[model samples]
Target: MAITSANQLELLQTAEAVAREKMIDPGLVIEAMEESLARAAKSRYGAEMDIRVSIDRKTGRATFSRVRTVVEDEELENYQSELTVAQAKQYLDNPSIGDTIVDEVPPVELGRIAAQSAKQVILQKVREAERERQYEEFKDRAGTIINGQVKREEYGNIIVDIGRGEAVLRRNEKIGRESYRPNDRIRVYIKDVRREPRGPQIFLSRTAPEFMAELFKMEVPEIYDGIIEIKAVARDPGSRAKIAVISYDSSIDPVGACVGMRGSRVQAVVNELQGEKIDIIPWNEDQPTFLVNALQPAEVSKVVLDEEAERIEVVVPDDQLSLAIGRRGQNVRLASQLTGLDIDIMTEAQESERRQKEFAERTTLFMEALDLDEFFAQLLVSEGFSNLEEVAYVELDELLVIDGVDEDTANELQARARDFIEAVNKQALDKARELGVEDSLVEFDGLTPQMILALAEDGVKTLEDFATCADWELAGGWTTVDGQRVKDDGVLEKFDMGLEEAQNLVMTARVQLGWVDPSELEADVEDEAPETSEEEEA
Candidate 1:
C-alpha cells in the first residue's frame, strides 16, 4: 500500500469513522494516524533518522519530513539525526546549536509487514485515547447515581453498560442476594472512577449509604432544594438502614418530607434498595439526644457520654434492653454509626449495679489510702470525693460540711490525706530513679511523680526521649484498623493526660532544648487565632 493522492482523503475518513464509533475526539484519531505513518516512514528512511509526518485537516494531504538538530560538537551523539553547529553551516547561512533543520521527504511505501505494524500502533493509540475519554467523562460523576443496562455477569460481578462505557458492580456492592441478567435495567451509585493500566474502571455500588441518601434526595423536594440536609446514613444493605436528616426551614419536618404523603417518597427508595427498611431520625446538635432518636422504639432511661473517648453509655429499662440492642445488636450499631460514637447499651438494673460497684471501689480506696474507718470513708465518698488528692487539697470548709466533723477533725483528715499522697509520690519518684530516669525528665513542669514513673517504665527516661514522643503516645487514642476502633494505651494516659496537654508539654520541652524557636511558636499561635470583626471586638 502506498500513500498516493487517491487514498489521501480515505485516511481522514477512516479516522473520523473510528472516532465517531468510539465516541472520542476526531483530532486524537488523526494524531494517532500521523504517529503510525511516522513510524512506518522511520522503517523505510532508516531507523536512525528522525522521520516526521503530518496530515492536512481539510485537504487530507500527507506530508513527510526528515528532521536533524544542530548540537554542540561533543553532544552530537546521533550521526543521522544530529549535526554539529560548524557542520550545519553548509545547510544554512548561520545555524545555532539547538536549531532543527527540516527537509521534505517522500512518503513511505508500506509493505505487508510495515502496514500490519502501522495498524497495531494506530489501534493502541486509539484505544488509549478512548480510555482517556471515558476516564475524563466519568471522573467528576463519581458520588452520583446513574441508570444503566446490565451487560453481563462475570464471577458474580454485574457489568453494566452506562451509556458510553461499562461499569462493574462487585458482588459485595450488591444489595443482599440481588441478581440481574443481561439487559436488566439497573440504578447504581457511581462509587469511584480510576484509571488503571488495562483501562478506566468505573465501580458502581447499590449498597453504599450515600446511595440511599441520593435516592432520598431525588424523591424529596426539600432535600433536593437544600431546605433539608441528610446528616448521616448507616446501612445493613437490603435489611435495614438509619438516616439522620435536618431541616433548615422551621416549617418543614425533614422526616415527614422524606416519608412523603402515605410513605410514598421513602417507599420509592425502599423498593429500589430491594425493600430495605429505613428509619428516618431527626438530626440533633447534642450527640446523646441524636443517639436516643437513632435507637428508635426503644425507651432510654439514661444517656452517658464520654466526650474525650467518643463513647456513649445508654441505659434502658430491663424490658427495653433487648429492644435497644435489637436483633444481633443492629439497633445499637446503627446508632453508633449515626452518632460517630462507640455505644454501650445496658439495662437500668445493670447501670445501678455498676454505679454501686464504683462507689464501693472509691470507698475502699479512701479507706486504705487515708487510714480512715469504713464510716468516715463512706461519708467522704458520699461528699463526691473520689481520690486522696481531692481529699487532701479540698477547701477546709468542704470537709467541715461533713456530718460529725468539726474544724479539728477536718484538719486531721487533710493531714492524713496529704501525708499518704506525699508518701505515695516519694515512692513513685524513688521507683522512677531506680528505672534510670534522668533529672531533666523528672524536673519537667507538666509531669507528676507518677507520670514520670510511667514514662520511665516505658523506657522514656531522658527529656529528649519524652520530646520525641508523639502526642498520642502520651494521651491514649483510638485507631481504626480494618474498619474497627482499636485502643492504643499511652504511657502517661493513666494520669488523665489529654492530647492538647501532651502536645503543649512536648512543645515546651522542645522550646527549652532550643530545638524550636519561641518566636515561631508565638507566630503559629497567632496564625491559628481566629480573626475577629471590629464589632465583635467592641
Candidate 2:
C-alpha cells in the first residue's frame, strides 16, 4: 500500500486536537479506532482473516495488516483467506508449522473502512469526554446559580445552554408566573448534576429558595457587604418570598436596608424574579415576634407559640385574617418556614369564641373540683371570682353584692371559697415541688402536712421562703422542672426574672431574714397595714 493523501493526515491531527480539548488520552482514541476497524474488517472480509489497524499520531496515516491462517488444503476462499507455510515464509523470517503470512493491505481498500470507523469512534469518544468534563464542572456548583441562554424546549422542558454545556430546566423548576423564549438569557440555580450513559445531566431551577437569596445578593449592597445577613429564607416562588434578615450594626435597620428607599432594592430583586413579592422580616430571637414579622402587612394581636408542639396560634383581627394568611395561604406558609412553626391563623371572633369555650371548661373544672353547682358557680363568677384566688381574696360583702346572693349565701360562699382556695393552694404547692420549684412555697389560709412537705422539698420551707421568690421564677421554673434541679436566684434569671417581682422578693426576704423589720417591709404594702392592725387588736 502506498502513503496516504493529505486528507488522511488532516483527520489524524483533528482527532488529536479533539482528544486534547476534551482531556481524553490520545492512546484511548487510537484504541477505540482500532476496535472499530477490527469490527468493520470482520464484517467486510471473512472471520478467519486476521486484521490489525494502527494509526500514526504524527502523520495521521492509517495502516491495516492482514494475516491468513496456514491451512493444509486452503479450502477458505477470500482475498486474504489462507496461506501455506512455505508461502508465508516469503514475508516471515522463520515460519513455524502453523504460522500465517503477514502482509499490509492496500490503503485504498482499508481507507474507506478506517475513515468511517474513525469518524464514529471520534464522535463517541468526544461525547463521553464532554460528559465527564460537564460532570466535573457542575459538581462543585450544586447549590449555586448559573446564567445561561435558552437553547430549546422539549416535552415541556427547557434546555439551557450553560457556557460549558447544556442543562435541563424541567417544567417543575420554572417559576410558575413567568415564561421564557429561545435565546432568552436567564439565571437559574444549579439544583443538581447527574451522570448518565447518554451524557451528563444538569438540573436547573428558577424556583429554589437560594434563587431569591442570590437575587438579593445581586441587588442589595448591604447583603453583599455583610452588613445585613439573611438568616433564613422561604419562598412561594413567583408569588412571594419571606426573608428573615438581621443587621450586624444597631443603626442599620435590616428590614429597611433590605427593602431600600422607596422599595428600590427589593424592587430590583422582584423584577429579576418576574415581579415576585418579597417580605423582608426583621429576624428576632423571640419566636412570637419573629412569627409576627414573618406574617407581615397583617397586624398580629397575639402569637401563642407552643414550643412543645412546634406550633403557633396567631390571633389577628377578623378583617386581617385574609391578609395574614395571604392569597392561598402564602403568607402563613412562608411564615411557617421562616419561623419553623406550624402556624394556625385565627380571627379575633374565632379566638374570642375559643377563649369563651376554654373559660367555660375551666369554670366547669373549678366547680366540679369544689363539689359546687352551676348556680353557685355563676354567682361566684358574677362577683369576678372566676378561680380560687379571686374567691379567696374577695370580701364577703363583695360576694353579697352580686345578683342572687344573700348575706347568708355570701357567708357560706366565702367559707366554701376559703376551703376551695386552701385545697387548690395545697395541690399547686405539691405540683411546684414535683416541678422542682426551689425555695418556693405557696401560702394560703390553710395547708396540709403533705403540702408543706412537698413545698419543703420544692425548696419552699415556709411563707418567708415563698415571699422571697419572684413570680416569674416560680412560674417559669415550675413549668420546666421535671423533678430535677431546684430553682435558685441564678435559675430565676434564666427563667426571665421580672424586676418588680425581684424587688418584692428582696424586700420580703430582708424582712423574713430579720435584716429589715416587718414594719419596714410593710411600709409600702398598703393592704398589709389593715392586716397588721387587726393582728395587733387580736
Candidate 3:
C-alpha cells in the first residue's frame, strides 16, 4: 500500500485512538496495521517473493521490503526464501550461504479494497485484545461476588452487564423464585470465566453457597477480617440456608458475631436473598458435635458415626423427624453437605424397631449355624455376639456375661463356630482347586485361601485378573438391581481386608507380574505409605 505523507502521519494517531478505545497495547494495533499493509503489498509484488513490511515504532513512516536467505545449491528448498551462493552474488558481493539480504520495494497505491482489509485487521486485533483483557480481569474473580445489571434474557437465561462485558446467569444457577427485568440490579457469584470458540464467557450464579459466604463477608466485619471463619455453607436458595462458623478467639462468639446486633447483619443478608431463612451455627471440630449443630432446631436422640463409611446415623424423636429431615429431606441433605458425610435420619421408633430386627436376625443366625437352642442363641445375642467371628474370637469372660453360661458351654459353642468356618473354608478350597486357581495367589499378602476361591469363582483366576479390578470391585461394591442399589461382597471382604489393604495387595500383584515397573510401584507406595502409617497410628 502507498504511504502518502497524510496517511503515514495519521497511522500512529489511529493506532493510539484504537488502543485507548479497545483497552489494549498501542504497539499491537500498529503491528496489525503493518501486517495489513504488507498483505496489500503482496498484490503489487509477486506473492511468491518473501514480501515484508515495517512501520517505524515512533514515526508513522511505513516501508515495504523483500527478504531472501543465501543457501547452498542443494539446500535451496524454496525459491522465494532461499538464494543459491552463486545467485546471492547479484545482491551482495562475496555472499556466504547463511546470510539474509533485505531489498527495498517501491510502494503501490492503497486501493479501497486494501483499505478495507486494513480496517478488518485492526478490528480483529482489537477483538483479540478485548477477549484477553476480559479473561484476565475475571479469571481470578471466581468465587467472588459481582454486581451487574440485567441486560437481556434469552429463553430462561439472563445476560448481565458487568460494567465492561456481559456475563451469563444460566437458568439452572438462578434462584427458582427470583426474576429480573432488564436494567434491574443483581448480585451474583462469579462461578467461572471460560474461553469458548466465540469468545471468553463469564458464568454467574445466584445459587452458589459461595455467594452466600461472600455476602456474609460483605455484611459481617468479623468474617471479612478473618477473625471468624465460615467453615462451611449449605444453601437451599429462595428457601433456607445453613452456615457453620468458628472463631479462634475465646472471647468472640462466632455465631453471635455473624448474627450481628439484633439480627441486623443476618437480616440484611436475608433481605437481599428475598427472605430466605439463614441459620448461623457455631462450628465444632468433632464430627458428632458439628453434626448435632448442623441438624439444629431438631432434637437428635442418638447419633451413630461410621468413620470408615463416612456416614452418620441420626435418630430423632418421632415428632422431630419431619423437622430433622425438612421438606422432602432437605434438612438432612444440607447437613450432609455441611459436614461432608452421608447422613441417614430415622425416628426413635424406627431405630428401636431396627435394633430389635437386628437382634432377631443375629439370634436366628446363631441358632442355625451353631445348632443352638433359641434360649442359648438369644443369650449369646444379648451378650453382644453379633456374628460367628465375634463369638469365636471373644474372651471366655464375654461369653460368661450371658446368664447361666459356663466355661464348658462357651468353649463348646466357640468350637462349633470354628468348625463351621473350617468346613466352609475346605469347601471353598476344593472348589477353587477344581477351578484351577494357582496356589501362589493363595499365599499373597492380604489374600486368604477363601478369598482366592472367591476370586476364582468370579473368573479372577490369575494375578493379572485380580490386579486389574478396581478398588471398589476388590473390596466389594454396590450394583443396581431393578433400579435399587444392592451390595455384593467382594473377595477382599471375604478375607477381612480393608480397602487400603485390598488396593496394596492388587498393586503388589501388578508389580510382581511386570505390568508395572518396581520403581513406579515404589513411588506410589511412598506417596500412600505415610497416610497408611497415620491411620494405623490413629
Candidate 4:
C-alpha cells in the first residue's frame, strides 16, 4: 500500500467537510476514525492484544500502538492489559508496577473487509453526531413556530424541509381540510424532538392549539411584547378556534390589540388558518365568568358549578338552548375545552323539570332513610339536603340554620348520621379484608376506608403497588392530543376523590414506603409512624 502523509491530509479535509456540513465538532469525527483504525490494527496484530490509535489533527497522521501495563509477576493477567516487569524489561530499561509501555506498530492497509467495517463506523458516528446536533437545535425551540416547505409525503405524513433539517408532520397533526403539494410553504409548531434508535425524529404540527397561539403571537405585537398573555387556546381545526387573552397592562385591551385596527390583526391569523373562525375572549379569574366568556354568543341564564367534580351545569333561556348547544353539541364541546371543565347544558324548562325531579328524590330519601315526617323531609329537601352524606357531614351550625330545627334536634340528626356512616364503613372494611387486602396497606394513613376497598378491587393489594403509582396514574390528569392539554378523564374520578385528595393520598403512600430518599424530604414520616401504628393497634 503506497500510503503517504499527503494521503492523510486528504482524510483530514474530508472529515472537516463532513463535520461542517453535519454541524458537529471536527474533533469527534477524527476520534471515530481513530477508533476505526484501532480496530483494523487489532485484526492484523493479536485480536486479544491492547491496541490504541490517534490521528494528528493538523497533519492528519494516523498512528497505531500496542499497549501493555507493567505489573508484578503474580498480577500479570494477559498481554491485552498487563505484562510482568521481567517481560517488560526487553522493551524498556526499567519498568515498575502500574507503568505502561507502548510500542509503535505499522499502519494496517484498508483491505476490502477492513475498509467496509471502517466505513460503517464512520457513518454510524456521523449519524449519531447529526442526531445529537438536531436534538440540541430543536429541543429548545419546541413549542415555537417554524416555516417549512413540503418536501414529500409518505403514508399520509408530510416531510417538510425546515431550514436546517427535515421534519415530519403526522397525518393527525394536519388540519382536516388542508392539503399541501411539493414546495408548498407552510407554518408548523415544533411539537417534539426525540432521539430514536435510527436518529433524531422531529414532530411538527399545524393543527396544534399552540400553532394557532404562535400565529397570534407573530401577528399581534402585544402578545409578542408580553403586554398581552394568551392564557389558553382551543381549536376545531379548519373550522373554528377560541383563544383566551389577559392583559398585564390594564390600559391595553387584549381583545382589541389582538383584533387590531379594522380587524387586520385577527384577519391575518384567520387568513393563515384558511378562514377558521376566531373568537377572542377576555380571560377571568372566576371560573364561572371564564366559562361565560368562553361560551360566547350563547346567552346563559344560570351556571351551577360543581367544583369538586370539575363540572359546570349551564341553564340557558328555552329559546337560546339550540344556540348554547350549537349544531351537534359543537359549541358546548368547544366551551368545555376552552374552560377545562365538563359542561352539561340545559334549557330553562329542562332545568326546572330536573330541579323538581331532584327535589322529589331528596324528599323521598330523607323520609325513607332519616325517618323524617313528610313535612320535615320536604323542608330538608328545600334546604338543599341532597343526600344523607351531606346532612351527616355538614356542620351542626349549618343544620341549625334549617327552619324548625333547634340545636338539640341538630345534635340528634348528626348522631344518627354518624351511626349510619359507621355501620356502612364497617361493612365495607369487612368486605375489603375478605377480598385479601394487606393489613399494612389497609392501615396506611391518608387513604379512606372506601379508597382502600377500591384499591383492593383494582388488584392493588400491596404497599409496593400503591407506592409505585404516579400521581397522575392514581388521580388522572388532563389528556393531551398532539401535545395540548385538553381535559381530565382521570382514573381517580371513578373513586369518590377530587384530584387534590388523590395527590395527597399517593404522596403519603410513597413517603411511608421509603421509596424516596431521606434527604429529599422536608420532614420525617418515621416520626409519625408510631402514632399511626398505635392508633391501628388500639
Ranking by TM-score: 1, 3, 4, 2
Residues 461-518, model 4: lDDT tens digits: 7788787766666676667798455665544556656667776777677777777664
Question: For residues 1-538, could you state the per-residue lDDT of candidate 2 as single tens digits?
Answer: 1235756676566667777876666677666666566656665665667777777777767777886776554554554667666776677877655666657875544467555775687678667767887898788988888899998888788899998789999888888846778999988998888888873389988888887888788777888899989899998778888888899999989888888889898898888787888878889999998888888899999889777446689999989999998888778878887887778889989999987786677568558765678776655555455566566567767767777778887677667767876776678666666665544234333234344455465566656765565655443432326522333343344334445555566556556567678875466576655565766778
Clashing pairs in model 3, backbone N/Cα/C closer than 3 A: none
Ranking by lDDT: 1, 3, 4, 2
Candidate 1 lDDT tens digits, 1-538: 9999899999989989999999999999999888989999998889999999999999799999999999999998999999998889989999998899999998879999989998999999998988888899999999999999999999899999999988899999999999898999999999999997793389999989999999999999899899999999999998989999999999998899999999999999999999989999999999889989999989998999988867899999999998898888888888888889999889989988998998999999988987889998999999898888888899999999889999999999899989998999999999999999999999999899999999998999999999999999999898999867788998888878888899999999999899999999899999999999999989
Model 2, global lDDT:
0.73
lDDT of each model, Cα atoms only? 0.92, 0.73, 0.85, 0.84
Candidate 2 structure, TM-score to reference: 0.58
In model 4, where is the ten-residue run with the lowest total lDDT?
Answer: 483-492
Q: lDDT per residue, candidate 3, 9-118, as tens digits?
A: 79999889988887788888888888888878886676778878888877788888899999889988889878898998887889997899998888778799988887
The best candidate by TM-score is: 1
Model 3 C-alpha RMSD vs. true structure (Å) is 4.1
- Model 3 ranges with Cα > 4 A deviation: 93-98, 400-403, 431-445, 448-457, 476-497, 517-519, 525-538
TM-score of 1: 0.96
